[model samples]
Target: MQQFIVTPEVRFLHVVTEPSLRLAVLEHISAGEQHSDNHAPFFVLETPTWDGEGEWSGRAEELRADYEELRAVLAQDVRGVSLPAIWKAPSGARELTRFCLELSEMLRRLSVSPFDGAVLVLAPVEVREPERWVSELKTLLALEELRKARLMVVEVDGSHSEALAVALAQEALRVDARPDEGQLREDMATMLAGMAAAPAGVTGAQVVGAAGPRGVSPPAKKTQARLSGEQRESLARELKMAPALFDPSFQQALRLKVFAAAHAMREGKSTEAIKGQREARDLCLDAGLNREAVILELVLGGYVLQAKQAPLALEVFCDARKRAEAHELAELAVQAQLSAASTLLMLQRFESAALAYAEAGKLGLVASQPLLAIEGYRMCGQVLARAGNVAEATAAWRKALEVTRSATADERTASSAPEVARQLAALCRKHGLKAQAESLEAQAVALEEPPLRQTQGA
Candidate 1:
C-alpha cells in the first residue's frame, strides 16, 4: 500500500528568456508527482494577459479557450484535477484592491491543502503596476487554505520579474533559456562592434593608432603574464590619447583600460584608476560583458576600500558578487565574495565577515581554486579571532592548514604552504593549542626546506 506524502511549502521560480514558460511549469509538476507516494490533486491557475491593456472581453474569451485546452490535456495524465481560475490583472490601485479581495475569496473556496499537491500559476508578462499586483497576489497566496499548496509562477525576464518574484514568493529560481553559445557569442560580438563604432569621440583609425599595432588586429587572447613598466607607460599614453578607446565595447579598448588602471593604481593615482574602472564597467554592462563588468566592479570596489569607505566598498563588492552569480561566473563571484568579506572585516561586522569568508572558502573549493579557499579560511580565522571567537578561529585556521597540507608538493610550493603553516602555528600557539602549534611549526619547517639537487651518476 502506498502512503500519501504531502509537500509542506510552495515554490516560485522564473524561467529567464522563456517566452512560453510551459516547460518550467510542466517539469515542476512532473517532478512533484514523481516524488510523491500517492495520488494527489493538482490545480492550475493562469492569468489573462501580462499587460492589462487589451479588451477584457476578448482576453477573457481567449483565456477561457486556453484554459479548456490545458485542462483537457492535464485530464489525460493527471488525476484529481479542479477547474483552473483566470486572474484578470487590474491596472489601477482601486481596481487592484478589489481584484485581490475577489481572488482571495476564490482561493479560500478552492480549499487547497498539502494533499492537493501542486498548483501552477501562469503569470502575465509586461505587468502594469507590478508592485501592487504582486502585493495583492502575495496576500491571496498567504490565505490559510492555500498555505500548503505548491504555488509556482512562471514569468518572463525584463518585465520586473525579479521584483515580482521576490515579493510574491520565498524562493526564486532562474532558468536560462539563452540561445546557443555560438549564436550568443556572435550576437555579443556584433553588439560590441556596433557600440565601439557608434561612440563619436574616437575614430577607428585613432583607436588603432592609440592601441598600437595590436589594435589593428583582433584583440590578443588573455594571458597570465604581468605587463612590464614600459608596456604600462605605453598603454597609459595610448589611453590618454584616445580616452574613448578605453571603453570595454572593444576588446582592445578593454585590455588598454585594464593596463591603464593597473598603472594608475601602481602610481598611486587612485582617482584615475576609479574613473577608468567606472567607465569600463559601464561599457561592459552595455556590451553584455557581465563577467568583465563584475571584474571591473571588483577593481573599483578595491579602490573604494583603499579610500577607507568600507560601507561603500561593501556595497560595490556585494553588487559585483550578485552580478557574477547571476551571470554564472563562479571564479569572479568567489573573488567578489572575498572582497565583500574583507570590507565587512574593515567595518567590524565580525560575525557577518566570518560568514562571508566561510562562504567564499566553500565557493572557492567548488570553483577549484584551492589557493583562494586557503586564503578565505585564513581570513575567516582572522576575523573570528578579532571578534573573540577563539575556539572557532582556531578551528578555521586548522582547517586552512589541513587544506594546505592536502595539496600536492608542487601545488603547496606554488601556493606558499609554508607561510600558511606558520600563520596557523602562530594562531594555534596564541590559543593554547601547544600540540597543534608544534605540528604546524614542523610542517612549516618541512615546507621551507629546499628541494634536493638532482645529480647524474659519474
Candidate 2:
C-alpha cells in the first residue's frame, strides 16, 4: 500500500500604496527574489494609494509577518526603494498617473501565477485625498477570485507624511523610511475613524486590498552597508537575464562574488582573488554585458593574476589581445600589449620583450597615449642594449630623447625619461657616440626640472 501526500500550494503577497515608499519595497523584494536562497512563492502588489483614503480587506496577519521577516533579513536600512514617476506635483512629489500603468502591469503578472499570495499597502500623503485612494482600495477588494490571498493596508500619519509617503510604506514591509511610532499610531487612528464613517457597502476593509493585518509596526533599523542609486540601478541592469537560462538570484550572487574577490585581492589572497575575478567576468557575460565591459573586467583579472602568477598573467594578456582585436577594442588591445610586454620581461626574454614593447608602443600611439609611447621607446632601448645591439639601442634611445624634448613644453614628461637617458648614454659610450651620450644627459637634466622651475625657465 502507498500513502499519498498533498503539498498545499503556498503563495505570499504584499501590496504597497505609498508612492515614495513603494520604490524601496519593490527594490527590496526584487533584490531578495534575485538573490535569496528560498524558493517559496511570493507576489507583491505595488501601487500608489490613488487618492488618500482606501478600504482594504484581506487575510492580514500572514502578510505582515512574512514582510517583517523579509525586511529584518535584508537589513533594509541601506537601500532606498525607487518608483517610476511621469511628473512632479505642485509640492514636488510624484503625481499618481505614473504608477497607474505599473500597477496594471503588476496585477496582470499576479493573475498569471496560481497559488501565489499578494500584499497591497497604500500610502497617500495627501490627507485631503484619502477618499480617492479609499475608492481605489475598494476596487481591489472587490476581486473575490483572489479571496484566499492575503492583503494589508498601511495608512500614514498625515503630519509625518513626509516620512511615510507611499505604497511600500503603506505596506510597511521594510523599514528604510519611517517616522515616530506615535505618528504611525495617530495615522492608524485616523484611518479607522475614517473607515467607520464611510458609506454602507463601500465601507471599511471592503474597498482596500483584501484585509489582512492592521496597526502593524515596522522592524527597527539596523546597520549595514547600503547600496547607492547607482549600485541599485547597476544591479537591476544585471538582473535582466532570461527567466529560463539563469536564475534571477544570479544578480545578488554575482554581487557577493564581486565583493569577495575585491576583498581577497586586498588581503593578498592571489588564488582566491583570481577566482573571484573570473567569476565576475563569467557572471557579467552570462548577464549579457557588452564586450567592452567584459574586457575591462578581464583586464582587471589579468592585473591580479600578474601580481601572483606571471605565466598565467601572460596567458590572460594573450586572451585579452585576441578578444580586443576581434571586437576592435583598441584601448584594451593596447593594455593587453603592455601587460604582455611586462610578462615577457619578467621571463627574461629580451627579444620577445622588445617586440611586445614595440607592439605596445604602436597601440599606445594609436590610442593617443604619449607617455606610454615614450616608455615603449625606452623599453626598446633597454632590451636592445641588453641584447648587445649597441647601434640599434643608441637609435632607440635617441628617439625616446626626441620625444622627451618635444614633451618638455607640454608638462607631460615621461617619468622614465631620465632612466632612459642614462641607459641611452651607456649605450652611446659603448657604441663610441660619447657626444650623443652627453647630449642625451643634458636633455634629461633640463626636462627633469620641477614643473614650477620649468615654468620659470620657459
Candidate 3:
C-alpha cells in the first residue's frame, strides 16, 4: 500500500444503510489523514441553508454557490502564501465556461500550495437530485489536480431511501466499520477534529503586472473541545423525572432488589447498581410487569449516567421512552424522551436533538405535565436557537411561556413560571421584539404576585 507516498485513485460513495457508520467512515478517513501534514485534508458538509428534508428550495442553479464555503476551506493552502490568483474564473461565466474556468482556476491554486487531495463528505440532510449533484461533481473531479479529491454522501440514520438508491447507482464499495459503544465514548472524549491547513513552501510572488487580492488571509484557527461522557447528567436528575406511570406490580423479592440497587447508587457502586436494576427490569418483564419493567429501566438509565457511560445511558432512555409510550406511561415517556433528547444535544447531533426535544415537548403536553411541558418546550427553543433557527426558537419559547402561564395556579408550575417568562422575554429583546419582550416581562412579574393580590389587581 505504501508503493507511492499517496494513493491516486479517488472515488465518491455513500454509507447510509447504518447511521453509526458515518462516524466510523470519518474515523477511517482521519486515519488516512494521520499520514499527511495537512490539517484539513477532508471536510464534512451536512448542514444545509435551504429548507427541505434534503436539498430542495427550487433554486437548483444556486446549489453550486451554496457550497462556496468549501472554497475558503480548500483555499486555506493559498492564504498568506505567494501565489497568483491568475486563474480566476469570470464571475459572469455560465455552463461549460463556468465548469472549465473553475477547474482551470483550481488547478492554478494547486500548483503553489498543492493539497495532497481531500476527502469531501457531503452528508446532506437529504439529496433530492442525487444524479444531478453527482454529475456536477464528476465535472469537478475530471481534472487530475483533483484526482485525489473524493465525495462521500451520507445520511446518519439511514432514514432516507435515497441513500440506498444512490449506492446502487454506483458499484458499491461497502464501508464495514461498526459501532463500538465503549470505543465511541473513548474516541469522542479525546477526538481532535481537523480543519483548514496553513500553506508551506511559498515565499514571495514576482508580479507580472500587478498583485491580486491578498489571497484570502486564513481565518483564525479555533479548536473544537473534546466531548466527554464523564460530564454529570445533572440536567435530567434535577427534573425529578418520574418512574413509569403505572401501579407497582412488584413481587416482594423484586422490590427488595430494586431497593438494593438504589442503595448501591447512594453508596457510589454504579456498576453494581446498574447490574442490579437490569436484573430487576428483566424480572419485571418476565413477570408480566411491563410498566414496572419500564420503571426499573428508567432507574437503570440513571445508574448508567452516573458511571460516565452517557452513550449507553442515552440508549437506555430511548428504549425506555419507546416502551413507555407503547405501555401508555405518559409521565415516564416524557421523562425518558427528554433524557434521550438532551443526551443527543450533548453528543452535538443538533438537528436530531431538536426534533427529539419537539417530540418530548408535545408528549409532555399530552401527558398534562405542565412543568415537564414547559421544560421540554424551553429546551427545544434552546436547541433550535443553537441550530440557527431563531424564528422557530422564539415560537418554541413562546409556547413554553404559554404553558407556564396556563398552569400558574399549581405550586410547582407557578414557581417556574417567572423564569420561563424571563427566558422568552430575553429572547424577544435579543431579536428586537420589544412589545413581546415587554409583555413577557410584565407577565413574569404578574406570575410572581401572590394569587390573592393578583386577582384583586385584575
Q: Quantify all predictions' global Cα lDDT against the true fold.
A: 0.58, 0.49, 0.57
Residue-pair clashes per prediction, in order, are 0, 48, 2
Q: Which is the leading candidate under TM-score?
A: 1
- How do all models score by TM-score? 0.43, 0.41, 0.42
The TM-score of candidate 3 is 0.42
Across residues 262-359, which tens digit of lDDT does each residue of candidate 1 receive? 55665567788778888879877876667678888998999878867789889999999899889789899899999999888888888999999989
Clashing pairs in 1: none
Query: lDDT tens digits, residues 55-138, model 3?
Result: 221111122222233343344533443334334335655444454455445444434444534455566544555556555555
lDDT score of residue 411 within candidate 1: 60
lDDT of 2 by residue, 264-305 (tens): 565567687777778777776665554644465665646565
- Lowest summed-lDDT stretch of 10 residues in model 2? 1-10
lDDT of 1: 0.58
Write down the worst ten-residue block by lDDT for model 3.
Answer: 192-201
The alpha-carbon lDDT assigned to residue 149 of candidate 1 equals: 44
